[model samples]
Target: MKYYSTNGQVAPVSLEEAVVKGLAGDKGLFMPEKIATLSKSTIDGLKDKSFREIACTVARAFFGEDIEPDTLDALVKDTLSFETPVVPVRKNCYSLELFHGPTLAFKDVGGRFMARLLGYFIKKQGLNDVNVLVATSGDTGSAVANGFLGVPGIRVFVLYPKGKVSPIQECQFTTLGQNITALEVDGTFDDCQALVKNAFMDETLNNHMALTSANSINVARFLPQSFYYFNAYAQLDRMGKAGEMVVCVPSGNFGNITAGLFAARMGLPIKRFVAANNRNDVFLEYLNTGKYTPRPSVSTIANAMDVGDPSNFARILDLFKANEDVHKAICSKISAYRYTDEQIAQTMQTVYSETGYILDPHGACGYQGLIDSKLTATETGVFLETAHPAKFKETVDKILSSDIEIPAKLQAFMKGTKQSVELDKDFVGFKAFLLRQ
Candidate 1:
């Protein structure tokens, strides 16, 4: 399938080009030329399929034309080595646990899928090393670093705000030495994102070495996230609770929810969506006022959702076309909710005390969205548990006044020494560093 840039200056290009280039020449996010809806029979078929099988079906719909069937199937299978279970949290609310993967975050599915797809393109074109630049608030750095670690023909640079990410989240990426590098920017997540975007747009940097983003801005990275929404629906379908299902996602850069919007467009049978936000509630403000205003992001316990200017909002606008229509559609199918740090902490503690379910700060925001929105008796709510609680042990432990055990996977990450370079969040400094590399 062909892809077009949201800016509309660049002509439509093949899927391979879109994936490789990441950002279009016009500095716009790439979007599919057309979204194909799945047949009702196909959606029903997913009920009996395994997570891998269902993911493969969804991947085939978007990527089959670009990748061989066998190759795409293998990629999907490898990326989803672990299952995203829909666990019961309350009477009608469920948590889609997405922290079962290597990095223990929802971004694993997208990061791994992008790594394999990029590897395929690199091998096919006989290209040299490609540098993947990603800006992360928390989980994304770890997810992308571990996902692309040791993969041939690709090197990953994870740029994150210094002292903002959790200790475990930082270690997961910084400790991995081979083919993975971390840059600790002396700014917020938005600064790191700006540096990455500037690097991609710079003629000197682009000419010096191959640079592409692995952030949600990349079509390859964000599109695969739809697999989670599909799998969640499949699980609910099996349980006979698929009717009037509302999927709530913790909104950050908006990539995850954008993917879900794509799924709904492709007939996922979702009744509506809920965008859960923290203090950095630019999207929430838009939902309330119907005006798009972006400012500096404020720090919150849910660090990942602290994106003042989400890169994928452009893709969302493009998806809906007109501004009024976009507002109406989003308002109709999605409810916007924002929570403060206190509320997130309280919800985390409350959910644990009531359900014995530990939620990371990010997931707490999602759960709170459901509670604040007040799901109807007939409506079943599924909120995405985006990360393992252990990732934010210090905060969660303090909130619950109990020591949370670190999973074996996270403990392993702590054993390695962090190896990250400190850099200022300036385009000139970032560009010079890339040239030196």
Candidate 2:
């Protein structure tokens, strides 16, 4: 399938070019020329399939045109080795637990898939020195770093704010030694994202090395995320409770929710969406007033949702504005809500006390969104539990006043010593450093 730049200035390119370039020459994110819809029979049959089978079916639609069927099946199966189970949290509310992969965060699915896909492309094209530049507020850095760790012929540079990310999130990336470099930038998540975007646009840097992003801007990274949504539907269908399904995502860079939107567009039967936000509520502001004013992000308990300028907003805008009323289309399908740090903490505490389901700070935003929206009695709501609570051990412990046990997977990352290169968040400094490397 041909992928075109959202900006509409660049000509369409093949899957290989879109995956490799990550961003378009026009500085716009890539969008597929077509979104394939699954037949009713196929959608109904998903209930009998495993997560891998459901993913393979969904994967074939987005990727089969570009890849041989067997090869694509293998890639999908490998990327989804773990399951994203929809556990019932309340009467009709569920938690799509996505923190089951190596890094135990939602990005693990996209991060791992992009790593393998990029590896395949590099080996096929006989290219070396491919650099993956990612900027993360939290989980993304750990997920992408662990996903590409020790992968041959690829180097991942994780740029994150110096003192913004939780300690566990920092450990997950900084401790990895082979083929993964952590860049602790002295700025916010937006600053780190700017440095990565600028690096892609730099003439000298591009000439020096092959550069691509693992951020949701890359189709390879975000498209695979649609797999779980289909699987979630299947899981709900099997339970005989696949009523009006509404998904609430704790919006960060908007990649995760954008992927869900793509699933809905592909006829996954998603009734609507709710975007949960923390203090950085630019997207919510956009939804309320129909004005997109990007601003600097503020620190919040839900650090992962601390994105002021979400990169995938362009993709969402393009997806809805395709020959229709843009604001009306988006507003109709997506409800927006924002929460304060106190509200997030309160939700986490209340959910734990009432249901014994531990809500990560990010997931707290999602849970609260559904609660605030006042879902219909027949609507089945699933909020993405984006990461394990232990990733934010300090915050969780403080909020609940109870010590939570860290998972063995996270403990392993913590055992390793930290190693990172600190740099000023200025683009000039970032460019000079990349050029030297």
Candidate 3:
């Protein structure tokens, strides 16, 4: 399938080009020139299929004949080694456990899928090396690092704000050596994102290395994330609870919830979507006022969702036709709610006391969003638990008055020492560091 830029200035590109180039030359996110809507028959067939089979069908519809059938099958197999189960958290609330992957976060699915696809494309083009650039608040760095680690013909560079992410989140990225390198930017996530975007548009950097991205802005990252919505539905259906349900997503860059909306467009029986947010509530304000505005991000306990200006808002606009009237209808189906750090802590404690579910600060924000959105009556509301509670151990412990044991995977990570250089939030300084490296 061919992809086009949002601005209508750039020429269309093949799936190969879209996957490799990431952002279009016009500096817009790449979107399919045409979207293949799921037929009734396709949606009906998905009910009985395995998660892997369903993913293959959904992915193949958009991918067309771009990837080899066997290669795509193998990639799907490797990508879904862990299960994404929707478990009961309360009488009317469910929790989508998306932290089962290697990095223990929702980004794992996208990261693994992108890494494998990049590997396939590099092999096809006979290219020996490439650079993958990513900007992260928390989980994204580790997910991308682990996903691309030691993959032949690729080096992955992850940029994250220093002193913003959780301790475990930091370790998850810095501890990974080999093909993975982490950059600690002494700025907000917006700064890291800006630098990455500027680097992609830089003529010198583009000439020095073949630059790509693993952030949600990439089609690769955006597409694989649709699988969880499928898995959530399948799990609910298997439990004989297949009615229309609300999904509360703790949104940061808004990619995860947008992926869910994309699946709904593909015929998932979603009743509504709730964008659960922390201090950064641009989408929240947009949902309430129908006016898109920019603001500075406020640091919160749920640091990952602290995005004042989400890049994926472009895709959200494209989904709703970029018209205020159309967005009103879309907002009817999507409700946004922002929570405070105190509320998140209270919700975390309450869930631990009542349901025995230990939610990280981010998940607590999602839980609180559902309550604030007045979805307590909805029996099928599923709040996305994007990370393991241990990732934010200090916050979780202080809130719940309990200690979380580090998982074996995280324990192993402690053995690998961190290697990173602190950098000022300046493009010139960052560019110099990249040059020296």
Candidate 4:
């Protein structure tokens, strides 16, 4: 399949080129030239299929022409070692638990898929010293670092804001000593993201090392996320509630929801979408006023959703720009709601008290978006529980007045001593650091 840059400044490239070159020359996200729609019968038949079968079907749509069938099937099977179950939390409401992976975050789906795909391309071309640059708010660092850890010929540099991420989230990546190296930047998530983008466009850095991103900005990372959306629909289809299904996403960088938009284009039968935002609500503002103004992000209980300038917003705009009235095109299909730290805390407490269901701060936003949504009696809602509540155990414990049990996966990470290289959030300094390596 041919992939086109959303900015339209470059020629169309193959899927391999799109995956390897993370960002376009014009600083746009890579978008597939064609959105292949599945047959209605195929969509209805998904309920009877396993997650691997459903994922292979969807993966075939995006990558079948580029990759051989058996190789692609193996990649899908290896990437998805766990199931993303849609659990019932309330009447007509469900939580698509995505925290079952190694990192216990939704980015695991994309991160692992991208890692295997990149490794395949590297080995195919006999490449060497392929450096992956990823910027994280909180969970992304852990997801990407753990995903690419120990992969031959690939070195992962995880740049994250210092003292911003949760202690548990920090341990997951910083403690993993392998091909992964975490860079502690003394700034916000936007600063870390800027450093990565700057490194990608720098001619000197590109000449020095093969630089690529594992952030949602990468086509390989975010596109694979659509697999879970199809799986969620299949799970809902089994319950006879897929007729008027509304899926709410706890959105941060907009990549997760962008994948959903891609799934909808590919005929997922979703009624519409709701984007849940924390205090850093740039996308929500765009939905309300049609003005996309990005500023500095503020720290919140739901640290993962704390993104001010989302890179995928460009792709969202470009996706709708091709149709009539860009703003109208997007607003018609998406509804957005923003929440404060207090509101997020209230949700985590109330939901646990009422239903005995734990909600992390990010998932709280998604759950509340559905609660506020004026859905019809027959409409069913599924909000993505993006991460495990224990990830932010300090905040979750304080809110619920209880100490949550940290899973063995997280506990193992905490046992190791952290090793990181601290740096200022400046491009020149970052370039010099990489040049030294």
Candidate 5:
């Protein structure tokens, strides 16, 4: 319904305002003013429902108060056109295959949902045009690009680090030429993220263009991610394995895992969570030392989770209150693990060899986290395989020593010529470019 800024310096606003103005004026992420819990009967009902049905139910809980019931239903229906199946990867371990969407990544649901929701708000307000600024390490760019592709009043600008993303990941966004523009920033993911944030705070840019973020900072972008978590639980419930479930998420900007925490708050019956990281272990370090230290991200095989300063960490702090309490609560329900590129490669190879399950580098981090954490026999581990393996064709091929078939969806993306603007990591240059547009 209503949303409050995590920084607490700004007044609460409606869902429409939060969706349109991504970052608060005080530079804080917007959070729901209240979390609504589901009745046990309602959670029980999800066991027999389709993914869309479950999603509509969950979406209504978060959005029904503000959006019309019929409109929210249609939004959930269109956004979740694809399924995220839970497939077995090992004994007592399941991989929540979230890469089945058009972009073949977990962000598809969020991106598509936000696109439709934002489009609705813009049309309702009769705005001429709205600009969406997103910074992606990998999957997010493509997801957002395609999600908003040709939507009537929205233009999406996806900013990503030059040469850091996988070839397929880069192609997926850069090649799409209508209403979607890719900015190849000559810096890390953090730099691209900073440019987006700085653009949102710039008075000239905001006055010139209605700039909003499609990154996890936007409530519309991240809240819909809760859909898959509820759907994951429903699937586990169907198999009678939902009793003791540990969900492992390959976290980058921490948005995916943060969504799971929100689901848990809404009575999702999750026993605990594991945040799997690759090289960029700032959150892991925080769990170990109770200190939040962010540095420049290091390039790794799992490039998507290569975020050094996750913006959603603020939401986690707001959810749990004081840092000490946040630390305690997070440590209690969530255990974090970090792995290197070598470990990710080894895990990918081993899982394919043993289970015949091909894992992308990002998913490998999640699989390794479950192995390293040692789930009890009574606990069923479900790791979010965030992206399709084919998206990292070269890396997967090298590790497996076999060619992985690219899906028709991805093969089509590769055929389009990449069309992206190169920019230095400076905000002024980025600002001038936007002002020119």
Candidate 6:
């Protein structure tokens, strides 16, 4: 498959090129030239396929002859080494538990897939000395750092807001030494993201070094996330509990829900989806009004979604701008809402009281969105639990007055080494770091 820039000014690129380049030369997220639809039979048959097999089928359909079948299979095997189960927490609300991966966060799916795919492409084409630039609110830096760590011929530089991320989240990224390095920027996620984008858009930087992205803005980082929507549907179908489902996704850069929009386009039987956000509720306003206006990001407890101007909104608009049919297909099945830290904490308390489920602040935001929407019981609600509760152990412990066990994967991470730099969240500091690299 080939991809072109949304602005129609860039050369079309092969799948490998798109994965490696991340953004088009004209500064657009590389969208698939075509989105393939899954037949009804294919959707029905998905129930029987293992997560790896289904992922292989979906990825192979897009990758085609570019990636060998065995290679894709092995990539899926290594990436999805754990399960993404939809655990029930209430009569209709389900937690689409995505922390089952190595990093105990949903970004693990995209991060791992993108790293290996980039690795595959680089190895196949004999490309070397690539640099991956990424921005993180909280979980993304750790996930990307861990995902691309020690991969030959590639170096990962993760920039995160200095004091915003949780201590564990910061440690997870900074501790992974190898080819991974973290930059603690004295600014918000938007600042980090801006610096990363500026580096990519810089002509001098492009000439001196090959730069790519690991943010959800990257098509490679977004596509694999579609797998869990299918996985959730299949799980519900197998248990004879399938219904018109509304998935509440904690939206930051909007890539997660955009992935779901891609799946629904492929004929998944989803009723609607909620793009839940924290204080950075730019998307929430857009869904309510047709106009999209961005503001500065605000810090909140659900730190991951603290994005004021989401980069992936461009991709979302591109998906909908094709035709009326495409627009209806995507917009009809989507909605958006925002929550505050107080609301998130209250919902976390309510869920723990009612369901004995301790949600991290992010998951609590998703749950709150579903409740605020008053989704019907028949319309099952599944909140995307993007990270482990233990990642926010202080809040979780305070709310429930109990300890949440850290998963084995995180335990292993705690044992590994880390490397990082402290820098002011300024373009000069970021540019200096790039020049050194």
C-alpha-based local distance difference test score of model 3: 0.86
> Which runs in model 3 stand beyond 4 Å of their true positions?
322-324, 376-379
Model 5, range 1-437, lDDT digits (tens) per residue?
A: 68999888999999999999999999999999899999999999998999999999999999989989999999899888889999998888999999999999999999999999999999899996899999999999999999999999889999999999999999999998999999999999999999999998899998899989999999988988998989998999999999998999999999999999999999999999999988899999999999999999999999999899999999988888945677888789889898998999999989999889999999999998988889999999999999999999999999999899999999999999999999999998999999999
Q: List the residue pairs that clash in candidate 5.
A: none
Question: Each candidate: what lDDT?
Answer: 0.92, 0.92, 0.86, 0.93, 0.93, 0.85
- Residue pairs that clash (backbone atoms under 3 angstroms), model 1: none
> What number of backbone clashes does candidate 3 have, counting pairs of residues 3 or more apart or in separate chains?
0
Tens-digit per-residue lDDT, 22-76, candidate 6: 8888887888888888888988888898888888878776666577888888887
User: What lDDT tens digits, residue by residue, belong to model 3 across residues 1-437?
Assistant: 78888766899999899989999999999888766677776776666888888888778766756777777888888888888888788776788999999988999999999999988899999998899999999999999899999999999899999999998899988988888889999999999999999998889878878989999999998888998988888778777665867889999999999899888887888888999888788888887887889777778999998788899998888888856687687788898887889888888888889889899999898887777767644357888999989888888888888978999887787778888878898999988877665
| Model 4 / residue 428 / CA error / Å | 0.9
Q: Estimate the overall C-alpha local distance difference test score of candidate 4.
A: 0.93
Error of 6 at 358 (Å): 1.1
Least accurate stretch of 10 residues (summed lDDT) in model 5?
322-331
Q: By TM-score, how accurate is candidate 3?
A: 0.96
RMSD to the hidden true structure, all candidates: 1.0, 0.8, 1.6, 0.8, 1.0, 1.8
All candidates' TM-scores?
0.98, 0.99, 0.96, 0.99, 0.99, 0.96
Predicted candidate 5: what Cα RMSD to the true structure? Answer: 1.0
Query: Which 10-residue window in model 6 sums to the lowest lDDT?
Result: 322-331
